[model samples]
Target: MQDFREAYQSTAVEVQENDIQDNEVELASPWQRIGAVLINSLITMVLYVPLFVGTAMMGDSNGESGVMWIGISAVLLLAWGIYQAILMSKTGQSLGKKLLGIKVVTLEGDNPGFVGTVLLREIVYNIILTVLGMIPFLGVLISIGAAIALLVMIFLDGNNRRTLQDMLAKTLVVKA
Candidate 1:
């Protein structure tokens, strides 16, 4: 441990961070991720419910009940995720990430706001994992794959505490 710290000190560059409290400087756990997701979900629901209700009322005024409201809601949710990713990459914090006292950055604490990186990590990778899980019987296989990916992210060895998305995005979550 002493040797590792010495090497890190000699080789690793320290990044100047935000006005983050010293006590908050800890690698976020999976539970923290869950909390962020919950917060983001709540925000999304607030936006969705109103739109759905308004669509229902408009549909009632017409001849038929409009099921397209559900479809629209789905699209809106996807849009929200994209928006969240953009905000997270730009500001280093999503609404939840900010509330939870964590921000995503690179190992060197620089955030690369490349769209390709964002899509690769948030849209392509995660959605692929999720889609596989939707398949019956194949869901176990999908879950195993996703678990492996998540484990790889959580256990980043000595380099940094990051997940697959972090690696792909060259980013990490630290106290903010």
Candidate 2:
């Protein structure tokens, strides 16, 4: 009877472990994720440059243009943030994600919504990075370290190819 009990317990433990492993959905391909990032970066740059230059060039010597630039930049950023937060939260797909046929979803494969995934999970990191970027040499060093760490984590993760941001967000990127 003791041997029978031990065998049952071992089987049960194995089953539980397998179930947990199975719950992790298949991840999107690395190339897809990279493509999404590139597309998003291009979009951001397109939106940023024209507004920044236009505002800067429009201001006179009194610094009105500078103030205008700041204000306009703030507004543009807010709008872009809202757009991303809403789309990602509601659909689990940003423009790039949609284009690449990938999605961001919760552990249970549900949309995490704007407040949970976008604002808290994603935007919070962006805001932190922006603040950090405003600093001098230290900021640049930190950014470099962050980029290296992100790549390392994604490549080296045995369970999933999750970057630091994905881990922090409690989200998964999966093929659609």
Candidate 3:
């Protein structure tokens, strides 16, 4: 009986050690996450510069130049989206994340593929937020509150600093 108990205890310890190693990931700090977000936002805003310039050059009239500019803007936006999706899917790092030395990964420490990164994290999450924002009277307020809640969740999650998008996509941001 004593020998059996010893064997069981050793096996349990080995299992525990393996579990700990599996979950050993250095989570990104809140500041790093915030920096990444700001960097990404800046990149997005920079991408709109051409659109703004084209609009200004074309004036208020919907002439041929205006239409062309609109087309250009659409193409630029689409290209940016594709770039982000590709990077996120391949390496779990967007331009901002790469700059910040952070990456998005599954809870198991694997890169989240396109379905998780683009579909669930980006498209579905944005759709939900957009739907909430489009509600009748309280739409704007609800949307703002939800955004705040998501941000707060990142800070409040003691074990894993996951936002709502991360939770929905079953992903985590960790140091690259």
Q: lDDT of each structure? A: 0.67, 0.74, 0.82
- Per-residue alpha-carbon lDDT of model 3 for 1-176, expressed as tens digits? 99999999899856643453488878888888889889888888877876776777676665667667767877888898899899998999888989999998876677889988889998999999999889899899988898788778778746477788987887888899
Query: Each candidate: RMSD to true structure?
Result: 7.4, 6.1, 6.6
Ranking 1 against 2 by lDDT, winner:
2
Candidate 2 per-residue lDDT over residues 1-176, each given as its tens digit: 99999999899856654553587666888888889878988888776764677566665574666666667767887787788777888898888988999987765666767765677667787788778877888898878887887767656547467676776776667887
**Tens-digit lDDT track of model 1 for 5-120:** 98786554443222222324567766676688689879988769746765666747642344556666777878887788778668777888889887776555556564433666
Ranking by lDDT: 3, 2, 1
Query: What TM-score does candidate 3 reach?
Result: 0.81
Error of 1 at 63 (Å): 5.2
Candidate that beats the other on TM-score, 1 or 2, i.e. the better one: 2
- Badly placed stretches (over 4 Å) of model 2 are 1-24, 59-78, 130-137
Query: How well does each candidate superpose onto the true structure, as a TM-score?
Result: 0.59, 0.71, 0.81
Evaluated with lDDT, which candidate comes out highest? Answer: 3
What lDDT is reached at residue 174 by model 1? 71
Cα displacement (Å) at residue 25, model 2: 2.8
Task: Indicate the worst ten consecutive residues by lDDT in candidate 1.
Answer: 14-23
Supply the global lDDT for candidate 2. 0.74
Top TM-score model: 3
